[model samples]
Target: MQEFIPHRKCVGCMSIKPKKELLRIVRTDKGIFIDSKQKMPGRGAYICKDLECLKLAMKKKGLEKSLKVNISKDFYEKLEEFLKKLAVKSFDAEVWE
Candidate 1:
């Protein structure tokens, strides 16, 4: 038997990619936060690490619909900032490319 690799779809790009390649956003009773470890409980949505995908997801309200909750503007701003920081720390370069 072969090991299975999980796959997830990006809410922004609608592209299917390996789970490890995407970022997970989870909505829990407490609030919404990026699930860096993909271990949070509650509804989850995936998005590409690229900022463009984040913009598209926000514009399309995909996260809101997927999480079945109203997302505030401040949350979006915070998510963007978090992603930017993660990109910086992970790649040590701009993620736009």
Candidate 2:
């Protein structure tokens, strides 16, 4: 039997993709966080790894709507920085399986 792969929708591009191919951001009681392990508890939303998608999410307020929280400008800046670092490291080696 074939394994069943999970799929999730990207809040930015509004495209459905394999869960592993996207990044997950979660909102918990404590605060919002980037769930790299995809195991964080709370309300979670998915987004494409591409920077363009991030921009789209910001422009459209996709993440905010999905998470039901008002995201701050500073948080977006931090998220952008994190994504930039992720982009750089991704090219070095295939970290995600």
Candidate 3:
């Protein structure tokens, strides 16, 4: 059987790419934040998983508009740190599966 790939649009560039190629920003009961685990329940907006897209989202306040909530600088800082960590984990030699 052929495999199916999931593609999603990047709010920044409006380009459709495989799901794994994008980063997920979510707003949940705990408040808005980044969800690298992809298992969080809430409203989510996707970016290209690149710094450029992340920057554009910030510059235009795309996420805030999309989620219809204010995103604090503290949230941005924590999410930025997580994105960096995700980038590092992406290249990790170990497999969780």
Candidate 4:
């Protein structure tokens, strides 16, 4: 038997990629969250880890359309900052490795 790898489409770039390669964002009764664990129970959307993709999604309103909710401006700014930190951490990890 072969192992199965799930795939998801990035709302930003609109490219299909393996689920593990994308970042999962979910919206629940509480609020929106960056689901690093990918186990949050709610309406979830995926996007590439790249900042450019994030911008594209915002520009195209892809995330909003897919999640079926209006995202606030502050939320987008916060998300962008989060992604920047993530990028820095990942880059450091790669360098150390």
Candidate 5:
């Protein structure tokens, strides 16, 4: 028997990938934040771990659409900083899993 792996679609690349392989950005009543634990309770949008994906998502306002809220520039800056810290360049399955 094999374990079931949940898959989610990236709003930027519009590609289906394993849930664990993508970064989850959630918007709650409190505000929007990166749900690294994926336990944040609210509307969530998934994106690839690549900076390009993040940029595309921002440009297309995909996160705003998914969360049905206006995303601030500060939030994007913070997210960019976080992604930089992670040094995410490409989709490395081994690193994520």
Candidate 6:
């Protein structure tokens, strides 16, 4: 089998990082969701495992810009809520789903 080292771009900072170094957020047929495992089927975007990165993505409208879809404030609120519940540490690893 060929060795694979996947690279994905951080939606917040637009920096390319190793897949394991970032988190995946996806919008699927069911609904908008976080894909922590990065194995879900959907249009996925990578992000840093930091709230500030999320905030940057939001403030820059990076998600909508990249996803090519409209996202409402409710979606942002939901993401914030989920993140709060997860109690993510500053440098802890995470997968959104």
**What is residue 23's positional error in candidate 1, in angstroms?**
0.8
Off by over 4 Å in 1: 90-97
How does model 6 fare in lDDT?
0.77
Per-residue CA lDDT of model 1 for 48-96, tens digit only, reads 9888998999999988888889889988887787778876656532232
- Candidate that scores best on lDDT: 2
Q: lDDT score of model 3? A: 0.75
Please give the lDDT score at residue 59 for candidate 3. Answer: 86
Per-prediction TM-score to the true structure, in the order listed? 0.86, 0.89, 0.77, 0.88, 0.86, 0.76
Write down the lDDT of every candidate, Cα atoms only.
0.84, 0.87, 0.75, 0.84, 0.84, 0.77
Indicate the worst ten consecutive residues by lDDT in candidate 1: 88-97
Model 1, residue 36: distance off in Å is: 0.5
Structure candidate 4, residue pairs in collision = none
Q: Tens digit of lDDT per residue, candidate 4, span 1-97?
A: 9999999999999999999899888989988878877888999999998899999999999889989999888878877876787777554322220
Q: How close is candidate 1 to the true structure, as a TM-score?
A: 0.86
- RMSD each, Å: 4.6, 3.3, 3.7, 4.4, 4.7, 3.6
Among these predictions, the greatest TM-score belongs to: 2
Could you give me the TM-score of model 6 versus the true structure?
Answer: 0.76
